[model samples]
Target: MSRTPEAPSAPPVDGARTTDSTGPDLAAPARRSRLVAVDAARGLALIGMIAVHILPVYDPETFEPTLQWTLFGGRAAALFALLAGLSLAFSSGGRTPHRGRALTATRAGLVVRALLIASAGLAINQVMPSPAPALGILVYYGAFFLLAVPLLGLRRRTLAGGVVVFAVLGPVLVHVLGPVLPEAAAVNPTVGSVLADPGAALAQVLLTGTYPAVPYLSYLCAGLVLGRTDLHDVAVRVRITLVGTVLALGAWFAYWVLVLQAGGYAQLTQHTPWLSEDQINEILVWGPSRDLPTSTWWWLLTSGPHSNTPVTLIMDLGTGLAVLGLFLLVARPNWLWTTLGAMGGRTLTLYSAHLLALAMTVHYDRPALWFAVHVAVAAAFAVLWQRWCGQGPLERGITAAVRGTRRLVLGAPSRTAASPRS
Candidate 1:
């Protein structure tokens, strides 16, 4: 049987982006693993992202299930970042020996695509500068792509160690260096408002999420490790899910106990009812923290958790099991599956369109109506575009661009390229 062409998949740069390499033990790819999880995860993330962006349609103050994401806590960007990390590992073909030239080219392609994703994100940013800035996960994911490529073939243990060290040190790294580095502090509202004075706006984008790359990348590496290792055992999957769930709850509770329920916390909560929500989210992400450095991000990222809130302690059980469920669901509901994938596949275009839609709201002062319209139009576009164009405009362009570049760089002129890497 002849094989048709595959679209070239680019490792998503900061989908929410990073890096370098120095250490190594050999590693290999798994003989049996299902990529459907990453795809399904990405598909799920895209759906949540749409919902998150559509929040203005409803009341921002309301925390409802449909609008609240369980995975990465509804952080569309984090989901993309985790997906990128997993895809990066999957693409490593972990078994193959690293070739400097070929890997360099692939890394280059990742860098280019990361920038494209970031650029798309920044384009979205032109509309919103602060609280709702369009650039979030894509910004980080794009940066991480460059940061992670060198370690692509590293052993699981080695990468895991890297994740741990970084997670432990990243906050102090962010705080100490934050004052001097305007970009790193951009994500911090107080600092951002201060820095937005005049010259800092352009420089702040890169700094939005600095040292925290460790926590952010942890999710990716976790996904990568899961993919690279033998995770198919029924028990192993359950164990991993259990670990994630426990960590998530511990993180949430720790924050609740240490911070919110704390005497000072109650005072602040009294002043602002929303403070609890914000702190709950922070506690959920960074886990329990004295304040800064010790913050063990509850879930590698709040966005993932925020966007896809797991209703139970073992919410990841839902994420892990959702894959099998989606497969089964798709088998029974092909159209729905295709629709989800189509939205994910065209994320770049949809991402940009989302910005335009958001801007429309801000500009017209009908932000509420615009938000709802954005959701309807974007979801409809995903369904219609897949049916009509088969791929989104920007998605198609990126696919062609990556494939052609791969041909030139890899020296394999296969008529078809691999599918687009998210």
Candidate 2:
């Protein structure tokens, strides 16, 4: 879910030092130069995700969507995935993608990292089981990383093209393939289930289940494009902000015009005769059930949270870019932002811990108190650990593994490689 920083001079992918050692010097002060904005954005995403997991999604009496659901429901995961792409880009080569053996080694390292994260997720699924407190994102992350391995060397323009392609086609694939494929058996898939019916598991992670990887490729490619840019430039940051705002507003406006002003809503109700008007409205507000009813193409026009349609993907992508751009504009050495940055830098540890804790407890009885406790403990732990140690425990272990894989594949570097600026 996250990695630690390296010196701004030359950060490697996954925070692996490509110098005489395989890790960073925890005592070094230069680590501050790593992008605080990126980390802060990641921290905010973590907070949003935690809130979504703990808070009530709808008001019991009003039957209206809760503020947390409105704000963070689908967007937090989008932001996290987008950041993951940025991390991949930063690690692989940033503005200049790696080639030859370097690229090969980078891909190898990524594969190892993906497997580790996915393995952890599968193991976690064993304990949490179906109807778990949270549908963990780690396993799907592995798929994302592996899918990205092939695209690591693409230029910024090409990656931007990739974003467009995936945004349109990925969801289309899901809509077409979802009904025919076997339905997913578990909400949180375990190793046993995956092994027993790999096809169904694959279908679930790729297209049917929550946070399907195929449609989500848009976010990853968008992040790749962002990472390939001069993020330090004020003009670039401003463009990101403007572009994001326009894209988000434009997508929403289009959805409204087509679905509401036009006949798209009428078509949805007509096609799904079993669902009442209230159920249709619920789908519009809270997202679809299992998968959006494929009875009508009109469903694609809706842009609700987790809808996984082109409209929803584009809107969420825009929202993610806006958040990242704003943070880039405002990030500083101040306490508030830096505290967030610290937490963001160790989300791999923090997020996993949160999931495990949720699995062990019944927080629904006192959701607000549990949410507060989760946030407080995560923030305090992150700040203190970041001050005392360089990388998170899980991040450190992953970094070491990735570095070893790189070393095995490419041998030692002749000179010290610079850290990436992610």
How accurate locally, in lDDT, is each candidate? Answer: 0.47, 0.81
Query: Which tens-of-lDDT digit does each residue in 1-422 have in candidate 1?
Result: 00000112323211100122764322211111233334444555655555555443223466433334333333344446545655665555433424666666666666676666655545544455554533344444455555676667677787777655544454334434445654333442223343454234333433224213434555556556654554334556556555654654664565456454654344434544544656655544423222222123222223223222222112332243334333322332246555555565666677666655544446345544755665566668877976787767887776566656665777864555555445
lDDT of each residue in 1-422, candidate 2, tens digit only: 11111111113333333344666564222224336888888899888988888988899999999998888878888888888888888888777778999999999999999899888888877888346778788888888888888889888888899899999998888888888999767876689889889999999888887778888888989988987886756788899988988989999999999999988899999998999999889888888755788888888888878888999999988998999899888788689988888888888889888888988867989999999999999999989998999788888998889999999999865644645445
By TM-score, the best candidate is 2
**Candidate 2: lDDT of 115?**
91
User: Measured by TM-score, how close is model 2 to the native structure?
Assistant: 0.91
The TM-scores, one per candidate, come to 0.64, 0.91
Model 1 residue 320 CA deviation (Å) reads 8.4
The C-alpha RMSD of each candidate to the native structure, in angstroms, is 10.9, 6.0
- Candidate 2: give the clashing pairs: 10-418, 10-419, 10-420, 11-419, 11-420, 13-91
Error of 1 at 192 (Å): 16
